[model samples]
Structures are given as C-alpha cells and as structure tokens.
Target: MNNSLDQESSRVNFYIRNWLLGILFIISVVGLVALIAPPNTNDSMGYHMPRVMHWIQNQSVRHFPTNYTAQLFLSPWSTFTILHFQILSGSDRFANLVQWFAMIGSIIGVSLIAKQLGANRYGQAFTSVFCATIPMGILQGSSTQNDYTVAFWLVCLVYYILLSLQDETGKHYVLPIGVSLALATFAKPTAYLYSFPFLLWLFIVKVKLLRWQIYQPALQLAMLVFAVNGFHWVRNFQVFRNPLGTSPDYIIYTNRAFSIPIVISNIIKNLALDISTPVPSVNRLLLNVISGIHELIGADINDPRTSSSNFQLNSLINQEDLAGNAIHLLLIFTAIAILGLSWKKKNFNYSLLNYILCIIAGFIVFCMLLAWTPFHTRLHLSLFVLSSAFVGAVLSKQWSLKVVNLVATILLISSLFWLFFNETRPLVANSNLLKTGRVENLFIKSRTYWYFVGRPYFRESMIGATKFIKSQQCTDIGISFNKLDIYEYPLWVLLNADTDKKYRIQHVAVKNVSEVKQNLEPFKRFNPCIIFDSSGIIFEKIPEQKGNYEQKWFLSPVSVLVKTKN
Candidate 1:
C-alpha cells in the first residue's frame, strides 16, 4: 500500500515540474518572436488588416460591396475570422502584442491537446516545442496573419471535443464541443473542411468506446459543438445568404469546374509539391483521365488558378529563404523522429483517441484546404503540428528497441538544434513589419511563403497620400484603388472618426488598358474634389500638379485618383 501511494505521489511531482519548465520556455520564445510585425502577404495586408480596422471603427459586422470579390469573406472573413480577437480593443500595439501571446498560446494549446490525446511527458514536450520550431508556424506566428490563430483553435476544439467524449456519463458533453466547434468554424470557414474527418473520428471513437456505452456522451459533445459555432452561421446567413458566407465560392470559384479525382490525386501531389523540391512523378495520364470527371474530383484539378500548367516549376527548387527553410526542414525531421520514437503505448485505451484524432484531423485538413493550401512550407505549418504529435507517439512506441531509440533521439535533437541555432535570425528579424521594399526582399532574400511572384503589395506611400487628401479639409474623398484602409489610416488612426464623414471611397477594377480608361472616366465624373491619380492610370489631371487634386501611385500597376465633383 505504501509503495503504490509513493508511485502516485512521484507521478504528480513529475507533472508539476514538467509543466512549469515547459510553460516558461513557451512564454519566452513567444515573447521574443512577437517583436516583429506581420511579413508581406498582399492579400493579408490589402484586405485582412483593413477589414479588422473597419470592424473596429464601425463596431458592427458588414459585407464589403466595394471590393470586387467583396463577397469572399462575406459572413465574417478576414484572415480566417480572427475578427473576434482583432476586434477586442483595436489597438495596433496591442494587436501586434497579441501576436506574441497567440503564438505561445498555440504551443500551450498543442501541448494540452497532446496530453489530452494520451501523450506522455516526452510526448507533450516534443509536440509543444516542435510546434515552435516549424519554420512555417514560426514565420506565420511571427507575422500578424491568422493561419496560426486558426491552427491553434482548430487543434484546441478537436482536443476538447475528445475530452467530452471521454465521459461515459454524457456530462457537460456537447456544450463544450459545440461551443468549441462554433469558435473554430467562426475562426476560419475552413473549419467546416474538418467535417468529414471530425465526424469520421467521432464514429471511430464511438465504435471503440461503445463497450462503455458512451453514445449519450458523443451525442452531447456534438450538440454543444454545433451550438457554440452556430452564431457564425447565423451571422453569415444575415450577410451572405449562406451560413458560412466566406470561402471557395468567392475565392476558388468551383462553379467553373469541379473534379473529385483531381482533388484526391492533387491532395497527395500537392503535399509533395508543398514540401519537396523535385516534382514527384507527374501523373499526367491520371490527370487527363480525371479531367473528364472534374465534377467528381479530378487530378489536374487545380483550384487556385484554372489551369494545371500554371504551376511555378522554377520556384520549386528556388526556395531562397535559407533560414526559414532550414527551420522548416529541421522541424519536419524532428516531428518525424519524435513520432517514430513515441509510437508505442502499452495500453491501447490510452492511445485510441489520439490515433483516431490524427487520422481524422489530418484527412479533413488536407482535403478541405487542398487546392488552396499553399505550396510552401509556411503554408503547411498546421499539418506539421498535427503530424508531429502523432509522430512523437509513434517514436515513443518504436523506441523500445535500444538502438532505434538512440538513433531516433539523436536525429530529433539534431533537427531541433539546427532549427533553433542556425535559422533563428531570419524569422525573428526586425518584426518583418510588411514594409514597402521588404515584400521583394522577402521574396529574394528570405525563403518565406511571400516570395511567390504574384502576391500583391501595399505601401505607406498610399496611406500618406490619403492623409494629404483628407487634410485638405474637403467635402468627400474618392480613390481609384480597391484598398480602402490604405488611404483611410492616418485620418482614422490620427483623426476623430465621430466627425460623421470618416471619408467616402471608390475604386475601379483594371483588367487591361481598356478597363483602365473606363475606370478613370467615372472618377472624372465624381470629380473627387481632389483627384488622387497615379502616373500609370490614364488621367487628364496633371500628374505633378500642385492644384486641386493629388494623383497617388502605389504598388506598380495600380494608382488612386482624388478629385472634386465640381
């Protein structure tokens, strides 16, 4: 009796010390990395940040009609629905700082998820730190974007639902999971992508747990998850006529074509395309066959762009951000090693939930986000985290063999050290604040996801010009570009928004030279009191005039014109 009591006490002490040290490390890294600003992602800068700013100013949720694809995140879309947290107080400094806490919080979430999923001490430690090391997670977490935010909640909700499923008595069951599901789905509509895997995992778990008759418990968990996540749906319906107003329709445009086989094949192919340099054997014949069945799921079923030939072959080998990639590669290896080493659990009951969790979670995520999933390491960060814990479990199980354990441990340590020691400089450098020239720099210098050639850019110059127009003490302000926040900042950030007229804005979509002319002629009619025109646009207003209007040119092809209606 004394021996048994001592064993229990020892276990308690071990957890206490482990938790304290692990938390300290998590806090330190998240704080240190938080110093940087969001890296350059045109879409993020153009829409997400601005959208949050608008929500802050308006204090209400509304659709963006002015934006061409304004309906995209129709219901509540902006950087995967971080609008909730971003809407908290609307302080730039605070939001930026939130980036730090969120990163650490994600590590905490990952650790908790691992433990709840039956991960042991080593499993928890490996999963938590490995999450920090992945280059994509580190890079995105360092930025102000919402992918990592979405990732954190996604993992947390899944873990919590499983916890609810743990009860044989159907306790606080569905309420917790329901609320969590609501939060997750609201965070990113992509959360719906998990439906298949989530439901699949539930069924699998139910089958396994039926010996204890946990059916009521499962039902309750499901109900609660639905309830918590239902608001997003309600609001989405109000705005877009759909519960989840923001997603593929506005972005992917599957109406033109849908291919199940291509989606399935590319689901696997894209994984390789995202991680490796060499194009794994082109399943050209398969793609051709899948093309016929696009509606069902095809092979060449490229979703981002309409054509399969659009793949940027040159970029596959040109991953320039050495530090980021080094971190990416090292983290991937460590996760694999950890999984390899932790693969064993003497008791199957303790391991069942996590096993089903990994399989279901991994499948849903890969499938739903498949076509839109980035082809770079940073884009694949969430997968790395999910895969790592499973990897850790596998590693632990396999490590029972003496030689295998040593080898796995050494590889894991080496990859981790390489990530932390060698590549720390790039990701955490100067907050990567999405400055003017940094977009191109990130492309040429850093092997980050931003290097992709087609991404958009927004500059402080645009904001500066907007301020100049607003300060003229004019009646109404008009702009020719789509980015409202680009010009709305200095005034909104510096001036009083209660002035009734924050500023009226307009923009034209320029597809070609002809569209450019058609876009400017209307601006001439509105005669934006002070025309903000760029040199690139066709305008009669003096490009260098000191007269009634200001012609502002930003990015390369796009410019804003402000002129009076008089």
Candidate 2:
C-alpha cells in the first residue's frame, strides 16, 4: 500500500513537471466540444451523410441509383460508422463523433508506433501531440471526413506490423495487421497507395523471419483483407463492369497528365499554399512562380476553363485558418536536421531509418503521380501521422526531456488557440459561451454548432426550400443539377424524417440547358410533383409543360418548380 501511494505520487509529480500534459488536455476538451456539435460541412451534407441515411433507410448496403457516381461507387467503410452511430443514437447529432474518435485513435496509434520504434514515454507523448496539432487533422477530426478515419487505420496497421515483427510466436499479431489494412483500404481507395509498400515490407520481413510457415499467415492476411473489402468490389464489378467503378475514367478525363517539372512546381505551390503566411511579398513570389510553371506547362493559370480545379486549390489555401502548414513544415525540417547531425552517431538505427525513408519517398511519389487535388495536403494525413514517429525519435535523442516538454507545450497551446479563434470562432462567438445547459438548447443557441444548420448554403436557402417542399406535400421530387450529390443530403433528411413510406427522390444529371430539356421528357412520366433545378437548367418552362409549372427560386440558385396542373 505504501509503494502504491509512492507510485501515484510520482505519477502526479511527472504530470506537474510536464505542463504539456495540461495543454494536451485543454486541446482535447476543445476538440470534444466541437465533435459533439452537428456536422454541416458541404461534403458531409452533399453525400457522406446522405449515403449513410440511404443505407439506414434501405436496411442494407446495396447499390442505389444516384446521379453522383461517388454515392454509388465510393467504398462504404467510413459511412458504415456514421450509419451505426445514427442508428444507435436515434439522431444525426453524433455524426462528427465518428471522426473525432478516429482522431483519438490516430493519436493513440502514433504513440504506439513511437513506442515500438524505441521511443521513451516522453517521446511517445510528444509524437501523439504533434499529430494532433496538425491543422487539417484537427479540422477534419471535428467534422465528418473519411481522411482521418483512414489515417487511424493506417497508423494501426503500422503498429500491428511492428508488433508482429517483434513477436517471436507471431500467431496473434498477423490477423490484426490484415484487419487494419482492410479497414484502411475500405475507408478510402487512396489507402492502397499509402499502404501497399508497407504491406510488401511486411511480407519480406515475414519471409525472412518465418520462411515456409510464413505462407500460412500470409494467406490468412490476404484472405482477411479480401473478405472485409471484397463486397464493395464485387458489387461494383456486377454493376459497373469494373471493380473500381468509374474512377479511372473520371481521373483520366478530368485531370491533365503533367510533365515531371509541372508536377514538382504544383507540389511546391501546394506546399506554399499550405504553410506560407499572408505576407504580401511572399504571396507575390509564390504567385509568380506558380504562374511561370503553369505557362511552362502550356496551361493557363487564369483560364476559366481550368478554374474549377484552381478554385478548389485557392479555397483550401486561403480559407483554412492560420495554422496552415507551419507545424508540419517545422516538424519535417527539424527531423531532417536532427537526422543529418546524428548520422555519424553510433546509436542510429539504420533499419528504422531506411523504413521511414521508404514511407516518405513512396508517399511523395504517389502524390506526384496521382493526386490532382488542390487539397492534396489532406491526402497526406497518414504520411504525416506516421512520420511523426521519426520526428519524436529524433527529438528524444537530441533534446532533454524538459526541453521536449517545453516545445510540445508551446505548440499545443498555440494550436489550440488557433483552432478556437480562427477555425471555429465564427461558429461559437455569438453563442451562450458553452455554458452548462441542455445539449438541445446548446445546439439551438450556437449558430455554428452544426455545419448544415449554421452554414450559409444550408441555412439561407436549403432549409427554406426543404420546408416549402414539405408544405406543398410533394411525394415525388426530381432533382437535376450539375453536382447533385453534394446538395442531395438536406433534401433527403428533411423529406424522409417522419415517413414510414419513403419519398421517391429521382436524380437527373444536367450539364447544360439542352440536357435539361431533353431529360424532362422521361421525368414527365414519373410526373414528379416538383422539380428542383440547381444547374440553371430551367431557363423557361419545358416545351412539353407550357403553362403547367410555376418556379419558386431560393438564394441557393435552386428553383422549386411546382406543377400547378398535375
């Protein structure tokens, strides 16, 4: 009993000595508050939540016709969590908690990997905090994005791989590695790019260590991965004649194949966008360089034709808050500097260093080759989270525990402040200050409490339009839009809220006015009581419908054309 008391006293002293613990606690509390809030991000409203709702309504995971190819083809692992949570909670209020838990799992996974890599407790704590402090991770963690979920699974895969390597018995660890890989892949197709090399490394290690017996576990791992993820592929193959669905064609048609120099230039531009502050001279230099590279590649940076992709890039760079990429850049540069200084030192672990280098190189090459988004930084979440282990390892070797604690404390506090003031302040600034109150009232008072409830797109027009549709008591609705998937969720949620019999919502793809006119013929037979036109498709009443329809326009540029003589 006396020894136990001494141990407890020591633990308390350790935390007091390391103020970073207190800082991490504070940041975690803020993240939890944000997670409990409702999800309202455009992507979440557009398809993520909608897809989950569809699965719940159907009571099974099967193909449904959707104008948005992603709703039909994207892997359902992440949405599965949302569906389960919504079912358990009996509401969508807990949707963001899935990603929040994923974030926490990622932090724990990083720490476990650091430990496996021979980091001390201080080093492990530092690495975990480092990952948590990334701006993209925090924002996505508090929202409903699959990137963090995939990152969590990838980190778990690494931790299990390391565990399997160290386990001489090796019976229990192989299955976990397989399960983690499957979960990661099913969560996001990009997981294949991020994880294939690591899986290959694991195979080589198993063969070197276990020889012929390795085949049994290896086969088991393969079977597990295939078993968990095969349904999605098989479904796609049956429907689309390709297991990957239309993504390959979409990629080929939508993105230009750039030369190596152009790709490199774009990467640097993305990096600058991610990390660089809003200094005028720095912005000017970055713009000039980006423009010069575009010119060299025979692409016009300002061409309206290419502006959609460019706008995505600009929005990610400009709209995201002040944390940007500074923390990531600093961690990377510091790791490199520490690696160089320690090269001649006797304690360097060459095997671990080689593995880390492989991961970094593989991720960079993958991004250069296939990642075309302006929001490419988000795609690198797994890469950065895994790399935090190396940064912690290096910092542990070079710096004292006290110094490491100080640095981590400073970073955590700064990141927490930026998250509160810059990223989420708009959501909570005019609220009742997060006081003790009922969850429902807190949600009601906080404008930014829910992304869909608080955001301009949903609040300004989508809600009103949904209400108007409900008031009209329309049973059949036809939705035609350029990108219907992103705007389909709100309508789905509002229309189906209290119904035992589902409302029939049909989607028609409309790229231009001619397509809309041509498509109206088929929809006429369905005789949808109303048509929601979002693509500016209904410039005038359809020739077939002459004087039967009247249009009601919303601020979203969405029109609810009710059939007056149906």
Candidate 3:
C-alpha cells in the first residue's frame, strides 16, 4: 500500500513539473481568486441570484408571480446549485464559484475525452489549457451565468458516450449517460442540440445490432431524465399551455421570413462575432460584412425592428473588447492544418470522425431551426469543447516536439495576458489588491471602485436606492423598471439581508409612469410601504390629493414613492 501510494504521489509530482501543467496551475489559481469576489454581472444581479433567493425564501421551487418572465420560466438546475451554496453560506460571496467549478469540471471532462480519443499526456494538457483559456469561457466561468454550467454537463455527456461505445457491456453505462443527459438538459435547453443527435445514433446502432436488452436500460434513462427535468416542463405547460413557455416564432420572429440566405448570413455573423478580437480593424471588417449581408437580405441593419436580432453584432462593433474566446479562430485553423497534414496517414479513426461530424451537423440544424442571433456562439460551446479533443489528438500525433512546445508557450502567455489586462473587468484588480492588505478590504474597495469609478452613475444609483430602501424600514416594497426584470439586484440583496423572515418584496412590470400608476391599483390593497422606480420616473397621486403619497429622490435619477395614507 505504501509503495503504491508513493508511486501515485511521484506521478503527480512529475506531472506538476511539466511546463504546461505549471501554467495551468497558475491560471487556475487566478480563476479561484476571482471567484471569491462578489458577482457583479447584470443577469446575475438581476435575476439569477434573485431567483435563488426567492426559492430559498419560499423553501420550494413552486411558480410565483414575477414580472421577470425569465425568472419564472427558465430552467433552474444551475440555480438549484447556487441556492445550496447561498443557503449554506448565508451570502452571495460564492455565487460565481458555481460557474468557476463548472469551468474546472469542463477541463477535467475535456481531458478525459482527449485521452479516449488517443491523445497523450502532453496533448491532454494542451486540450485542457486551450479550453480553459477561452476569453468568454473564463468570463462566463467567473460569473453566475448558466452557459458554462451546461457546457460542463455537455462535455461529461460526450465523455460518457465515448466510454459506452468502447465498453463491451454497454448496459452498465446507460444509467450514467442518461443521468448526464438529463442534467445537461436541465441546465439549459441548448443541451438538447448537443446531446440528442448522439443519443439518436446510439439508439439506431443498438437497433441494428438487435440488442433488445438495451431497451430496458434505455427506458431507465428516459425515466431518469423525466424524473429530474419533468417538473419544470410540466409547470410550463400548465401555466403557458406550451411546454417551452415561449414559442420559437415568438422568440425569434422578425419582419423578414426565415430563408436560406438569412440563415447562412446569421451563421457567418455569429462565427465572426465569436472569433472577434480587441483589434479595431478586424471588428470593423466583420461589422461591415454583417451589415452588407443584412442589406442583401432586404433587412435594414440599423432599424429598431432588427436590433434585437442583431443586438450581438451591434454590441460587438460598438464594444470590440466584448470578444468571446479569442483563440477560437486559431483553434479552428490549427485543427484544419493538422487534419490536412495527416490526410495521408492510414490509421485515422473514421467512426469518431463521423460521430463528430454528426454532432456539428445537428448543432447547425438546431441553430437554423431556432433564431438568428449573433450570440449563438455561446450555444456552440459544446462544439468548441469537442473540437478541442480532436485538435489535441491530431497535434499529439502529427506535430513535432518543438512545434508543440512553441504553441503551448504562446497559449499560456495569451491566457495570462487576457486574465490580467483584458477589457472585461478581471476578477481581481491588481491595483486594489496592492492597496489593501486583507481580502475583505480588497472586496470592499473593489466594490466601491466598480460602483463609483467603473460604471459610475448607474451603479451609484442602484447602491443609493438600496441604502434608501433599508433606511425607510419598509416591510413590503414594490419595484418597477422600464426594462421590467433587470437591475433589481441591489434592492433584493439589501432588503433580503436586512430582515430575517418578515419582509415581502414584489416586482410590478410597467413601461412608463402612467403604467406605473395604473399597476399600483392591484398593489394598493396590500398597501406597499414603498414603491421604488429604477427607471428614473416620478409618481404623484392621480387626483393630486395632498398627504396621500410622498415622493423623495433617493438618487437624482432614482425615486421612491412612500405611502403615508391608505
């Protein structure tokens, strides 16, 4: 036993000494430190964390009245994990940790897939680091977003699928594959695109082989998926009469009908945006191409009607630094180069190649059938991960040692540079850390920096409004905003933390001050102590009665209407 333990320890030490492994360790430590900082992402503060808080308060996952349609309808598996951590810690200090851990899990799952695909230790290390260094992955991994969480589950499903294919007794692995698929689907609806094709292939192959025994395990798999994710769909059906809660046409509609040219144009634009970098010339060129394509398709690129569909492309042109996965184009080109060089090699695994092609084909079909959004790169995360494994395998076999080392060095440097000085606010600000001796002090200083220096007016308004709400000692508050569900995080966090179990806060959706006045009718019975508007709107009694309501400006733009009389 001692000899075996010593051998294992020595193996670990040997791997740690490798240059690539050392770089990976450094990068991971940086991610861990970033995870400790408070989550400040818009979606997280707006709905992700708030939804978890709501579930914890209710002590169940039942549907509730919410102005944020997404908060009530989106899959909650990722939030379930966040809820556990929030409940355990009694704070959101670890909210981003869930995504960070998912990043780590994805790395492990990618490494396993590379190994199964015939990559050596160095190749596996390269694959792990390559996936980890993606700018968007790191950014999302350090937030409360569900994309990375679902990506991790997708990687695991692929890994398990490969294992089951290799196993002589496939029945034993069906349960795990089923569980992984269920979890992946539950994490995000996009998982169906990533996992369903492979599942169908598995079933077809089994049928051809006349493996009737596998049917029982397949049924078990179905049962497991239904057990885990069925409730959410059932609830959606009950409430919206549509299992998905929103129709595909409603979600992805536009003035122009869906056509082949539009689909191709959208896919190209999505790819361009996904691989865009901080470089100005590249961004300008990509934006021009996208705009020109829109013109050819009879769509006015800048029209408000097209903004929602083209929002990502517009944002990319406006904010070039918002590029995702800086190495994506490089990864694709390298994979192509490697495959071309190895074309003469007679020992290629055609089965694996066919399977990967099917997965990619399914993803493209899924995207075409859904909407044309430039942010669809996030939906392509599983493809990126799978491509990394193939890239690793090809590099391990075709590339020379010197070439591999050079590529590793460049990737490591690029990853570190992005981690430290990328346009996106890093997890840890070096200047803040240098100024503060303790982590808590750094967090405080960082929050103040972000609130005052980074986002300035908007963040300050949120903080000021939260402080004012706490001071008012309101037992119940009603919040309304122009955007309906977003930018309510500050109030939710503060009000929930202030009272133990005696506060109720409800969100009312309204478009303008007139709508706000109209919506207050339903809440008047509850007599909300305060009505907070983050949209810079002011309210007065409709009849101009004195002393019925008092309005005060918490921030110049943010106002609170207090009810002094019923």
Pick the TM-score winner.
3
Model 3 vs. true fold: TM: 0.83
Flag the better candidate by lDDT, 1 or 2: 2
Taken over the whole model, the C-alpha lDDT of each candidate is 0.46, 0.66, 0.64
Reference-based lDDT, residue 171, model 3 = 45
Summarize candidate 1's per-residue lDDT along 421-530 as a digit string, tens digits.
Answer: 21222432222333332423321343322312223233344445545555666644443443323322322343333344565443333222122223333333443454
Off by over 4 Å in 1: 1-30, 36-40, 68-90, 97-99, 169-172, 203-235, 246-261, 277-309, 313-365, 368-379, 400-464, 467-471, 482-560
Please rank every candidate by lDDT, starting with the best.
2, 3, 1
TM-score, cand. 2 vs. native? 0.82
Error of 1 at 34 (Å): 2.4
Model 2 Cα lDDT, one tens digit per residue, 1-566: 99998985686358444645654564575466555556666667667887787677556676655555577677778889888888998777777777778878887788888888788777787887788777667667767768889999999888888787667775448778889988998898778877877777778887887789878887888899899988989878766777766642333312245556545554555465566554656666767777777777765553332222452223223222222556776777787777777778888766567657757665655645553455566666677778878787778767876677677777677665445533332333322233333233323445333445434455546666766877776777777654533566767766666665457676644332223323333343456778777766554424565466678656566778888863
Worst 10 residues of 1 by lDDT: 314-323
* lDDT (C-alpha) at residue 479 in model 1: 36
Instruction: Give one clash count per candidate, in the order shown.
Output: 61, 3, 0
